[model samples]
Target: MFPTRAYSRDAEAIVALRDDLARWQVASGIVQWKPGEVTADQVRDQIAEQQWWLLRDDGAISATVRVLEDDPTIWDDLVAPGTGDALYVHGLMVRRTHRGRGLGGVMLEWVESRVRDAGRTTLRLDCAAANTSLRAYYVGLGFTELGEREFPPPYKTLARFEKPVG
Candidate 1:
């Protein structure tokens, strides 16, 4: 198991993790619309929203993900709708060099534990519809496809999936 830690929203380490996440999105061809500026302020906003998590190994940030603990309905229209207690996962990414090192699975387990600790019963996430490999990857991890949606122009479609925490 990798050494993990929970980072506060104001942590400076998250800036690097956010850059890595944005880079991964570009490298994976998952982000069609590139932001002109990936400012620390933007990263801070994500953290201030209490949706960001930084995973570290040997005291270095290796990956990051965001958990939506508030209303699931916030993303209900953006992804497949779900009922009951659940946490929505957004922007899960690992450093390119860190990919294929089993860190993703470890981080996922971390997410599950976090959701369970929050008294939620399920975890949900979504991926671009065109990302077939990613869809299959999540399926391999036991997440079931619930539905699909087409985000407005620029982002055409996304596939939604969910899995029970317990």
Candidate 2:
């Protein structure tokens, strides 16, 4: 298994990783996250809240993701009221240089383990509706599309997905 740990310091490194991916998305015409949208402060808060995790390879951060107990903004309308039967994953990012190395699946499996450890039966996540490749990737990973939702300005339609955990 790839070495994994909860995010503790160097929030800037995570931000940099996300910005790099955002730039790559734009250059590749992927309508996903935007550059300069992720800030160190936000990362720090996430770390402080114990919501972030990192996967390291050869002592360097290879990927990162945020796992949360609840995400009302994107999931409230979809999940049953007051049922905390799942863990939500957000901001999954892999370093550009580390793409195609299965790090994304590794990190997701780690999160699935966490979900099981937490006694949750499901893992949930969402991506931009315009990102067909990513949506298909999630589907290929055993995640079933829950539905789609449209939010206010600055946020496009989002496709939500969930996978059952042991």
Candidate 3:
């Protein structure tokens, strides 16, 4: 199994990982991670409070994922933010050179385990609605899209997905 660990005192690695992913996404025309999509402080905060995990292989970071207790901003309509059967996922990205290597699925399995241990029965996430390939990818992994959600500040439509855990 690839080594994995919950975020610790290494804030620098967290920032670097996010920056690399964001830059690659923008350069590749994936609007999901455009400028200001995530900030350094946001990464730092996730490292501090949320259940963020880092995966490493051969002494290099391969992927990162954050699992939150709930995501009201995105799923307030379907399930109440703090008291749902689902654990929300955010910031799940595999490094550029590591894509299509099953790292994303591995990270997701880790998330499923974490959520199962916490007594949550589902894992949920939201992706840009326009990103059809991504939505299809998640579906291929057994996640079902609930539907499109509208945001208040007029952000891009987000497609929500859920998969039963444990």
- Give the CA lDDT, 0 to 100, for residue 77 in model 3: 92
> What TM-score would each prediction reach against the true structure?
0.75, 0.94, 0.88
Candidate 1 clashing pairs? none
- Candidate-wise lDDT, in order: 0.71, 0.88, 0.80
lDDT of 2 at 148: 88
TM-score of 1: 0.75
Which residue runs of candidate 3 sit more than 4 Å off their true CA positions? 6-9
TM-score of structure candidate 3: 0.88
> lDDT of model 1 at residue 95?
68
Tens digits of per-residue lDDT, candidate 1, 71-107, equal: 4443565445555477878767676678898777877
Q: Which candidate should be chosen as best, given TM-score against the real structure?
A: 2
Q: Which ten residues in a row have the lowest lDDT in candidate 2?
A: 1-10
lDDT per residue for candidate 2 within 1-166, as digits (tens), equals 6535556576888898888899999999998899998799988998889888888877778888888998888987877645789999998988888889988898899889988998989999999999999999999999999888998978989999999999
What's the C-alpha lDDT at position 31 in model 2? Answer: 89
